[model samples]
Target: MTFGWLITRYMYPCFLPMGEWYRTPMDKNGAILKIDLADFQPTQHLDIDPTHHVIVNGLYMPHTVIRHNERLAYCDSMAYRVEIEKNAPIQLQGFTRGLAMTDDTIFIGQSRMRHVLRIPHAFSNCCLDGGIHVYNSTYRISRFVSLPAQQVYQILVLDQDFSLERGGN
Candidate 1:
């Protein structure tokens, strides 16, 4: 299985007490690890970007990665972009989290930053709300549905013929 790495010093800030926090510096690189299930060991490790600084706690974090049609696609949460294999990164309007794709559509979940020290310069003046942004095959925003919650962690695609009766079995 493939796993995306956050590559940070502080792994769980949410588990800390209300007023307490960690001030350690985070690693400035992102990586994807491929593990062998039979032996439970890592077989490969690919850095997202090593030459250029690509990992920032709240700016360029890799949140999710998925394989679609034999190609890899992932979200850069705070950077508000989705990087697909052999294609330019698709820009989004908010912090990207969940991601699902079909033959002609891409669904992305947006969320608000929690406990961020400072807003990134690229989005300092922008108001990013939680929502589901749907994109077309050509990488255009086809639709957007604003959600009432502060965060959306995951998204799953269901087939057109899927039904409750089939799921219960």
Candidate 2:
């Protein structure tokens, strides 16, 4: 769906039970996280969109996922295909294929095209690092670094995942 459709579906309300943009991520039935837009986190860093293009701002970094940037129109790369199961730990080989996959393993495809996603306001082009999101309660990811003769503490990132309510009338 186009960004316009996203606005109409999430930000706008209909006679049905659809909610506001802030209240949506929809569900497996509708658009999930992959296509769902997350508000950009205001930071002094440059962000990269899913199309491998630069989504910029004042402070910028290279190759890092922008706080609120998105990727769309993706395809599965057979060579780099990865599937991770729920409640199971991921080794972080790369970004999630698409936020849509819920059951079994989250499928992360490859971004091999442009035009699918675009940037609104850009600052500069830098691609060095990237990041991911961890949602509330039942949803999240835990990471730790190991050092010689040192104890490791797990770090947790809190995020909220929202979506339109499902109903039958």
Candidate 3:
């Protein structure tokens, strides 16, 4: 009824599949356990073994989840950067949560400030103020729109026109 090492490091090992448990050894606490679905099961692992692991960069206190194509991205609060598995570098800059992805653009909710940040797919850097900010493929801020703020919890891109409308049901 126990997986030995899996039970000591991970909780409820008998109830989960082998692949669902992620070995995030790169984390400061050790490893970061993950599941394919949020509701399928909770609780993961943190491998502190420094020899046979590679902790993810800038993922000390990850909080948000955003889908980037086939990859899942999120922000590490303690590390202060957006950490993604498939693209670019480890940490982007500024802590992030509430991830929203579109065809050519991506949006993230800033934890420190009350704003929804925009980072274009084409460009390397972007910004946000009150409403919205549009960025080109070159990572430059091209347009800005005034939007009402209420401590943004999350965002989602409906179409490719660079529009972020909040919807929670």
Output the number of the TM-score-best candidate: 1
The sequence of per-residue lDDT tens digits that candidate 1 reaches over residues 36-121 is 23323257653433223322233255666676786667787656778787877888767788888888988889888674653455
Ranking by TM-score: 1, 3, 2
Candidate 2 residue runs with Cα over 4 Å from true position: 1-98, 113-169
Cα-based TM-score, every candidate: 0.65, 0.18, 0.43
- Model 2 lDDT, full chain set: 0.24
- Taking all chains together, the TM-score of candidate 1 against the true structure is 0.65
Better of 2 and 3 by lDDT: 3
On the 0 to 100 scale, the lDDT of residue 78 in model 2 is 14
> Which portions of model 3 show Cα errors greater than 4 Å?
1-27, 30-32, 36-58, 90-93, 113-150, 159-169
